[model samples]
Target: MDLYRSGDHYVLHADLPGVDPGSVEVSVEGGILTVKAQRSERTEHDVQWLASERFAGGYMRQLSLGDGIDSEHIAATYQNGVLTVTLPVVEKAKPRRIEITPGASEERKIIEPADAPEQANKT
Candidate 1:
């Protein structure tokens, strides 16, 4: 399994040659993603004894997602014996530009009411 980030999403690729696409299962729970696949063994009774080096059995893989990941929008695709999974970044976790406004400094004068009495003594 190989994982890398591409644009706003993280991509995961796995090689599963000679495996049926229908037998593969993917699930996510508690911020963890799991992949399971089954490769059936060949059943030949009249064949001569030969050396076998290929793997034929149940395959599984799991990954723990971080807080920045958007688990609700994950997507997976299988093509040409390769499985690709896309995990998008959360909206709040993505980088954004904040606009800043310049501050204005001004002075104001206070006016007294005509009915108010003025001070008679200046000390």
Candidate 2:
């Protein structure tokens, strides 16, 4: 599993080969992203091979995400045996312009609001 930070996004890539894409499941709960993959075993009957070497096992990976992640906008894709998961970054607690005049700065105290109220306002 690989974790990377992009502009306004967090990307997670898990290398899962020999696993069926349909059987793969990805979910994020309690700020933790979990991935489960089920790989079916191959059977060889009445045939003897000189050399046979292949990997077969169930793959499971989990990641504890950092702060600021929009879990609702997360997306996952599986192609070419690689699973690509993307989680949009939640707006960070940064200083935003409050649109105050030069004189107002002396009298006004900028108060940083909590993230919960912002989310409530959106709804």
Candidate 3:
């Protein structure tokens, strides 16, 4: 499995050759993302196999997502035996530049209480 950040989303790629796309399942719960796939075994009684090295069973993987990720908008796609999952970052979590405006005046004003004697003397 390979994971990387792309723009405002995180992309995950997993290799699942010889596996049916219909048998793949993805779910997220409690900030944990789980991926499951099943590869059926070949049942051939009339033919003899010379060698069998490919995996034929269940495949599962899990990942813990951070608070910045928007789990509700996650997407997954399978193509050419490769599965790609996209995790988008929340709008509030994204970084942005803040604009600063110039003030109208640089003068400072101080308000004094009516009963204050020291403030009256300064004025």
Q: Write down the TM-score of every candidate.
A: 0.76, 0.70, 0.76
lDDT tens per residue, model 2, 7-95: 77878888888888899999999988989998877787898888867767777787877677788989999999889999887777323
With a 3 Å backbone cut-off (N, CA, C), the pairs that clash in candidate 1 are none
Number of backbone clashes in candidate 1? 0
| Predicted structure 3: clash tally | 0
Per-model CA lDDT versus the true structure: 0.89, 0.82, 0.94
Q: After best superposition, candidate 1 residue 23: deviation in angstroms?
A: 1.2
Best-to-worst order by TM-score is 3, 1, 2
lDDT of 1 by residue, 21-117 (tens): 9999888999889999999898878888689777899999999997999988999999998999999999898889999865576566565765344
Worst 10 residues of 2 by lDDT: 92-101
Colliding pairs, model 2? none
Indicate whether candidate 2 or candidate 3 has the larger TM-score. 3
Residue 14 lDDT in model 3?
Answer: 97
What lDDT score is found at residue 65 in candidate 2? 76
